[model samples]
Structures are given as structure tokens and as C-alpha cells.
Target: MKAPLLLHVFPGFAVGGAQVRFAMLANRMGPRWRHAIVSLNGRMECAERLAADVSWERVPFAAEGSLPQRLQRTRALLRTVRPDLLLTSNWGSIEWAMANAAPGGVPHIHMEDGFGPDEARGQKARRVWTRRLVLRRAETVLPSATLLEASRHLWRLPEARTHLIPNGLDLARFAPGGQGGDGLPVIGTVAALRAEKNIGRLLRACALLAGEGLGFRLLIVGEGEERAGLEALAGELGLAGRTRFAGHMPDPAAAYREMDVFALSSDTEQMPFSVMEAMASGLPVASTSVGDVRRMLPPEQERFLAPCDDVALAGALRPLLCDAALRRELGAANRLVAERDLDQDRMFSAHASLIERLLMSRAALAA
Candidate 1:
């Protein structure tokens, strides 16, 4: 039989959590389906992660014009592609969901990877209503319990159609390794230098530690438009000497191994892949408590997580920096948690089952 075509739509396919997860999924499920990806903003940085054997291509999309006009165009593209399944990512690709909203259109699945800066604090009414209206019939996937709860309470999506599938990591690649190169401890974070990631908060927290004569290196990994501003902020805070912005490491497993502790300062997130990778690498984490992070980490690591404020985050990091034994203890616990709960094989199985079920259901309906 012919391989079914699965078309994925993302707002901008930068190397973020959602895109990386999709890449892992596509790579693992190679040749089972022909994959067509559309990045609305024309950025496909994460495309390199896909294996050579994976049958996938980028589908051109014109996101120009108003919402209604874009929807009309997207519908035309959908009809032309005639995919067996349509998968849309986050709010930016909601218009694609609208385009495929008709009863007889392609089978659709929507994945929500938390929010951007705009809706970090709360959800917008318009978006809630739009999701409620457009996604009633489509399967909705959320990678965090926090987001799954929001889908039911805020977006008012039905329980039956919503799936909570946490992001998973390859535990073997991120095995425990020696940390700290020089005398000073290394505190690191892997995140796109974006506003919502709040890398500035991490910088400021480190600055607070530095002001008290604390000695450590801060390594900020990943690249984005916010790099220049964050670099400037690091300089302004007198952290230029201690901070290193390691931009866009294709394989971040090594990045996690380089650090004694992993930091997440994002104002918004939902089961961030960085945190999972860090845990798999057997590193203790110091982070702003956001999304499912509080739940993802071991109970012992909770003291290291603070509210979204810099001072609070700094307070959380202070102890983790000073105590080597505590870091080792928490790191080991984190690795255990990852091995027990965050294995990628389980995630791959869940996704494969979901895809198979959806395809079979669509075939049944057609019959």
C-alpha cells in the first residue's frame, strides 16, 4: 500500500521544543509516512535534525494578508496537498486548523506547546473561543498537565479529544558526566534567546550572585533574535567576563554534560525539552517554576525552583551553587526520574499509536 502523507504546520520552525519533538518523532517513524512540513514564517532551522532516510519535504505557504484571506489560501493549499493527516502546532498555526475545520476535510491534530510572551500570564478570550470553536472535532495534544488542564478549563476543549503526552528524551545520549572545567562551578541554561525565555532574568539572577562575590561561570546556549539585547544586558550587569553565549549547538546533549547545574528562567513553558535533557544528563536544575516544571523535577529539587522574579530565582540558585553534595544528590535523583519517566521510546510508542488510531478512524468514517 502507499505511504500516507502527514502534513505538519508550524508558526516558525526554529529549533525550539515543539520543532525538536517533531523532528525526533519524524526521525523515529521514518518511511512509515511521507511528511510535508510548512513553517509559516519560512524558517526551517530545525530541519537539519531530521535523518536522511526520513521521507519529508517543506511545503511552501504564503502567510501574507489578513486572517480571513490567509485562511482561504491555506484551505486551497490543504486541498492541493490532500494529506491523510494535518498536524498544526501552537496558536500561530491556528489558521491552518480553521482551514481544515470542515467536516469532510483531512483528519487533524493540534499540538499546544504552552504560550509565548503575549499569553504567559493568562489566556486571551478571543483565542480561547477560537480554539473551542475550531478544535472541537480535532484531536488536541498537550505535553504538560498544566496545559491539559487549561485546555479543559480555559479553552473548554472536550476531555475525550485532548491528550496529555509529555516531551521525552533519549536518556542514553545524556548519561551522567563530569562537570566543571576550572575551579569555578558552571551554571548553564539551554534556551532560545527569546523574550519569553527570560534569559535576562537568568542573567540578572547570576548578577545578584556575582554581586555577593560568588564565583561561577554562566553559559547560555541556543540562538535567537534576543541575543544582542541579552548580550548587552550581560555586559551592563558586569557579567561580560563570566558569561558565555554559546549559540545554537546542534547537539545539546554535550551542552548539558558541560554544566554542573541546568537553569531555566523562562516566564512560560510546558515540559521544556531542555529540562528533560538536563535531567537525563543527571544535572541538578535551578529554574523559575513555570508550567509542568514543578511536577517534572523530583520533589527534592523543588527548593531550587522559584517564582518568575529574578531575586527569587537567585535565591533558589544560591544554595545549589554553594553545595556540591546537594547538587550531586539532586542530579542523581533527576537522572533516575528521567530514566523511569522521560524515556523517548515510550513517547514514540504513544505518538505512533495516536497516528495509527487517527488514520484508522478516518478510514472507517470514509467507509
Candidate 2:
């Protein structure tokens, strides 16, 4: 009885939500399943975050000359690995679906977590056609109901083949009761410094609160291309001393512990792990009503405001920061929600069970 092989393909294996989820699944699956991670861009820092025993490989995508050359390289890799199941995520690896299907058609699973700024609002026709063509043979996995519907109606995927598996939080690592440091109120957000995250909005909101004579510090964690621009914006808004861009912290849980209130000002998101981690750390969140965030949060802590509205965000932030008792109450409520629904072990079990079921059904069909 040979152990099952699961190969996961992604744009990069960096410290992102998808990578974290994959690491959790691979580590917990243990010896029963062999896991290999393929990062198209050769960024495997997140692989280091995985458990020591877990095995993985990094394949850099060389987009040098022609489309055929790229396709050839992808096919060669698929042939060499010959994985039992192929799991590719996002737009960057959609082409791998075509490569997997080209040669003997492996049991490919395409997981659509969300999209970037280009297709943030909805799926474009070109992308939809490409997905329908490339992903026709694979089963689709969507992490949010919003994405599930997009796959069905927008990408025209069959309802039978689509599975909705929400992202889960690690309760132990992100548990509540961590103490805040001695300082003015701290409002923090943990996300990649990408345009979609809209850290500028958070900065503006902080400036508004500060201008109103509130004593608080703003901490923006994580890093990306927008670092310099955001720093300049903070300075321009007269928040040079008050706002801190912490870059990429290895342990964001520690940062979450220091914050009086957590905030996410992303223009687009689908079940952001940062928010879940914040909730698990017992921090009340104020975020834009994007994706399934409203559904994921408790009613009291849902505080979903319009994205980029500094006034509305400022209004929301004042109560959470000034009212100590309110913050504690909301924090307690959030932690309870996380403990009840977002435990990492339960998430790992659910994913493993789903994979097993898929494998069994495929085997039965082959028989």
C-alpha cells in the first residue's frame, strides 16, 4: 500500500494565507500522504515555515522566450514529478491545468482563492474563457462562497465539480489573552503591502483619528512593492512619527498581541487569515465589507465599513480605541467565535477527508 502523493502549485510559497493553509495541511497529514509544493516564481520562504519533516520542491518559471517554451517546461516538470494528484492555485498557475491535462490527464484540482486587482470586482470574460478551457478537466475548489459562485456563473464551471472549503485559523498559535504593550492605543493591520490591501486608507483613517486629538499609533505589518509609496503617504499625512511600517514579521501573532484594535482596509479579500488571527488573538476588528468577512466575524465585531471612507472608518475606530470595556467585550466575543468555528485541527481534518473522498471516488470510477 503506497502512500498518496499530493502536489500543490502556487505563484509563490511565501508567507501568505494560501501558503500557510497548505503548510498546515501538509504537516498534519504526516506520513499517510506525501506532499510536494511547486512555486512558479521560485519563492519558497514559506516552505521553511513548514514542519521539518515535510518535503517540498521549488521550480522557477522561466518566461524567457516563447509561450511554447514555457508550456514545454511545465509539461516536462509534470512528467518528471508524475504526481498522483495535481493541485494548482490562482491565475498564475492556471496554465499548469492545461499542462496536466495534456499528458495522460492527472486528477487536477484547481483552487480559486480569490483574484488580484485586475479582476477584483468580478471575473473578466477573457479569464473566464481561459479558465473554462484550461480547467475543464479539473475539479474546482473555492475557499469562499463568493468565489464558488464566481466559478459557477462567471467561469461557467459545473456545480457538481466545485467545492467550497473556507480558510481556517490556528487557534493555539493565535489564542487570546496576550497583553498589549505600554503605549497609546495601537491600531494594527497585517497584510501584504499590495495595492489591493489599501494601506493608504488605513493611514488616512489613522490621520483623521489623530487630527481629532486621539493619541494612538498605527502599525502596518507585512511588505510588498508599495512600501516606499505608503511610507511617503504616511509622512505627507503628518503621521511620520505615529505610523510604523513593520515590514514582514515572522510571527504576526506577537504584533496582534500588542494592538488595542485590529483593522483591515483591503479593497479586496476572501476570508483573510489576518482577520481570523486577530479574532483568535481576541482583538476587535474594523474592516471593509469585502468577500465573506462579514459572515466570518461575530455580529458585534463585524464593524464592516465602506472601503476608502476615512470618516466612517474614523467613526468606527474611536469607540473601539477609547472605550476599554467595549474593546474587551468585543475581543472576548471574537475569541469565542474563533474557538467555536476556526480551529486549525478541524480544518486540517476536513481538508484531508475531502482529499481522501476525491481519491476514493476517482479510484472507484477507474475500477
Candidate 3:
């Protein structure tokens, strides 16, 4: 018998957290599973990370239509591929949820990473109902406990069908104890400067830190549509000399070590990989209390968690950035939390187990 086929649908396959997670799971699971990826907008930048031994197919979803027509198109493809399982991600691919409900559609698992800029405040009534209705039959997976709650209470998803699978990192690869910068303390963050990421607020917060006359360099890693706006904001805030915008780099592990402190200023996130990577790099973190971040960090570090604004985030950053001893102490504690709880082996195994269960049920029904 051939290995079971799992079809993955993503908004785009750039080197984002979701795409990276798919590659990690596929690479580790190896030949035991055959995979197919459908990027709605067709950016396959992360495909290069997949191991050669994995059996896979990559086809950009090259079609345009209204939402209902898109569902019909995806439904037709579902019949053609005849996959054992269909894994759809984020709000962008909710059409697959509709597709899987069609006759002869595959069993599906819909993964909700987080919301786009539009739904930043809360889910709009239309999309909320679409998710509630379309995702009724599928197992909805969320990495954030916060999202998990939202799914159950707000979206009215069945508690039994909702799954919380925290995004995990390859712990050994991002291990701590590397050389760090000594010249000036570095306040760094690795995020595309998107509207939802709220990098502008972070820059303003950096300016706040500077107003207090702290010695630091704000290293803003990654690039996106909001980059120009952020650069101009930095100049306006007099952070032009202090902030360094390093356009997207493939590897962030080395850069984590170069930071005296790590930051996350996002308006929303569901277990961001950068935070885990920072914790694994043994760097103290100062972040807004978004998603499961408050629970994600060590108990003592919770005080540094703030609301989503420049002043609030700056207030959180001040204490950690000001005291070198506190930074060292918190960094050690964060690394221990990563080692104790956030290992990728656990995440990989959890996903493999879920996938295998889905495949086995499909096999049983066929038998």
C-alpha cells in the first residue's frame, strides 16, 4: 500500500512560521507520509527546506473566482487528488472547509494560526459565521490557548473537536550559550513589519526608551509592506540613528544571540516562533500580552508582559533593558522553560499522531 497522502493548504508558502512548521513536520516524518502543498498566491520560498527523502508535490493554486466558485474548484481538485487527509491553514483557506463538506471530499483538519489585519480587533460577523458553519465537521487546530478559547466560546466550535497544538522549535538547533554583543545592549525583534505585527508601536516604544537616555540599538529584522512606513516612523521619532532594519534573513538563530534582549510588539500572535527561538537562545524577552505569551514565559517574566501600545510595551521593556543582572537572570529562566516545555519533538509527535489517526480512520472506513 502507498503511504497516506496529506494535502496542505496555505495562503502563501513564504518563510513564515506556518510554512516553516509544515516543513519541519514533513522533514521529520520523512517517507512515512506523502505530502502536497497548495499555496493560494504561489510563493514557494520555504519549499527548499524540505528534506529530499520526503515524497511531495507543490502546485500553486492558479485559479480565480468568487468564494463559492473557489469552493467548487477546490472540491473538484479534492476529488482528483483523493487525499487521505486535508489540512487547511488560517482564514485564507477556509474554502477547503467548504470543499471537504462536498461529496467525496477528504477528512480535514483546519489550523487557525491567527487573524489578519482586518480581524485584528475581533472576528467580523460574516467570517465568524463562515468559520462556525464551514468548520463544523472538521477538527479545528489552534496553537494558542487564547485562540482555543475564542474558537469554543466565540465561534461556538465543539470543545471536543477543537485542538491546541503549541508551535514547537528544534531545541538543539537553537540551543543557548553563544557569544552576544558587548558594545551596546541590543533590543531586537524578528518579525515582518506588517500592520498586525505593530512594528511601528515597537519603534515608538524604542523612542520612549531612548527618551529615558538608555544605551541600546533597536535591531528590526525581516521586511514587508510596512517597512517603509516603519523606517519613516523611526526617523520621525529620532530613532533613525539607533534602529537598524536588516531585510529578511533565512536563519535567525545567530541573530538571537547578538541580542541582549528580544521583543515582540505584535497586535496578535498565536505562539510565534521568534519568541520560542529567543527563549531557546537564552535571551530575556519583553513583549505585549498577546495570544498565550503571558503563559508562554517564565512566571517571573510575566511582569514584563504589557498591553499592545508603545507606552505600555516601553514600560515593560524599561526594567528588563535597564538592569543587566535582571536580563541575565530572566534569560537563563526563559531558556530553562524552553528546554522543559517547548521541545519540537513533542510538537512533531503530536502532529504525526493526529495525522496518523486521521489516516487510519480513513483506511478503516475504506476497509
RMSD of 3: 1.6
Query: Predicted candidate 2: what Cα RMSD to the true structure?
Result: 2.2
What TM value does model 2 have? 0.93
Question: lDDT for every model?
Answer: 0.91, 0.81, 0.87
Candidate 3 wrongly placed segments (more than 4 Å): none
Model with the higher lDDT, candidate 1 or 2: 1
User: Which runs of model 1 end up more than 4 angstroms from their true locations?
Assistant: 180-182
> Which window of ten consecutive residues has the lowest lDDT sum in model 2?
55-64
The number of clashing residue pairs in model 2 is 0
In angstroms, the error of model 1 at 364 is 3.5
TM-score of 1: 0.98
User: Could you give the candidate ranking by lDDT, starting with the highest?
Assistant: 1, 3, 2
lDDT digits (tens) for residues 1-367 of candidate 2 = 7677788888877788888888778878667777777787777767766777775555456745676787788888777777778888888887788677664677888887777887667667888899987877788888888888888887888888888887887788887765454578789999988888888888888889888898988888998889999999999999999888899876788888878899888878888899899989998888888888888888886554455477777777888878778888888988998988788776777677778887787678678
TM-score-better candidate, 2 vs 3: 3
Give the clash count for each candidate: 0, 0, 0
